[model samples]
Target: MKENVFYGKGMGPIKRDFPDIYEAIVELNDAVYTGKVIDYKTQKFIALAIAASNSDDRAVKKQIQSAINEFNATKDEIMDVLRIVLLTSGMPPFVKAVKILYEVME
Candidate 1:
C-alpha cells in the first residue's frame, strides 16, 4: 500500500502557496542526496523529531511507524526522539505528537 496522506498526489498547492519555502526544501533534499551529511537512520530520527516538534500528528505517526518498521527502531528510540523534541520545542506539541504515536502503536 502507498501510504501518503495526500493520497499520492503531488504537493502542488504547497509549492504554489509557499514557493520560497518549497524551493528551500527541494534544495535541502538535493544537498542531502549529494552530500550525505546524515545517514538514513539519523535522518529518520530528525524527521520524527521535527514532525513531533511541529505537532504534525499525521507526519509524526507516519514517520515513527516507518522508522520502527523500516529501521527496526524500538519504542524507546521513538520516545527518545520525542523527549528531545519536548526539550527543544516545548510540551504541548510533544504531548500531541506522542498521543498520535501511542494510538498508532497500540
Candidate 2:
C-alpha cells in the first residue's frame, strides 16, 4: 500500500483536532489490512464489493483507484467483484458502481 493514500472524508480535520483518535483509527486500519492469509488485494476487492453493495459511489471509486494504483488490479478482477454485487445487491448499485469503475478507468 501507499504511504499517504487513505481514502476517507474529513480525515484532515480528525487528524488535526483529535490526533490520538486518528492514530488509533489508523492503527486499527493497519491491523485489519495486514494481508495475512487473504492478501491485501483481495481485501480491497471485498471492500470494493461492500462499497458497491452499499451504493457508496465515492467509496467504490476510491477502492477501485486504490486497487489499481497499489495492487495493479486488472479490469477482470474488478468486474468479477462487481458481478457479485449485481447478484447480491441487485441492479442499481451494481450499475452505479460499474459506471464509476469505467469513469475511473477512463
Candidate 3:
C-alpha cells in the first residue's frame, strides 16, 4: 500500500470543506519549503526538528520519512536533529520523536 501522505484522518474533509484554507495552507507549506538561505536538505531537517519539538506524532513521522526518502538522512543525522529537541523541549518530546522515528524507519 502507498504510504498515507495525508497525515491526519480528519484532514481530507477539511480540504474538501474548506478549499480556500487548504489552498492557503498548501501555499504556505510551499513557501517555507522553497530553497532560500538554507538548502533543501537542511530545511527538511529543521522542519523535522520543529515537528519533533511540537510532539506531534504524525508530523514527526512524516518529516522523518521525508528526510529519509528525499535526503537519504541517516540514523546519526536524525539523532542530531533530536538532540536539539532534547536540549530545548526535554526528554519527553525527544523520546516521542525517537519512537516515531523508529516507527517510520521500520
For model 3 the local lDDT of residue 34 reads 74
Off by over 4 Å in 1: 1-35
C-alpha TM-score for every candidate: 0.68, 0.94, 0.81
Among these predictions, the greatest lDDT belongs to 2
Pitting candidate 2 against candidate 3, the one with the higher TM-score is 2
Candidate 2, residue 86: the lDDT equals: 99
Give candidate 1's TM-score: 0.68
Instruction: Report the candidate with higher TM-score, 1 versus 2.
Output: 2
Q: Residue by residue across 7-99, what tens digits does model 1's lDDT show?
A: 113567768897887687677665553426666788778878988888887778778888878788887888898899889999898899778
Candidate 3 Cα lDDT to native: 0.83
Estimate candidate 1's alpha-carbon lDDT, on a 0 to 1 scale: 0.75
For residues 15-53, could you state the per-residue lDDT of candidate 3 as single tens digits? 999989778877777777677787888887887898889
**Candidate 1, which ten residues in sequence have the lowest lDDT sum?**
1-10
- Total clashes, candidate 2? 0
lDDT by residue for model 2 (17-84), tens: 99998999889888888888998888889999999999999999999998899988888899999999
Instruction: State in Å the error of residue 4, model 1.
Output: 10
Model 2, 97: alpha-carbon shift in Å? 0.5
Ranked by lDDT, top first: 2, 3, 1
Computed on alpha carbons, the lDDT of every model, listed in order, comes to 0.75, 0.90, 0.83
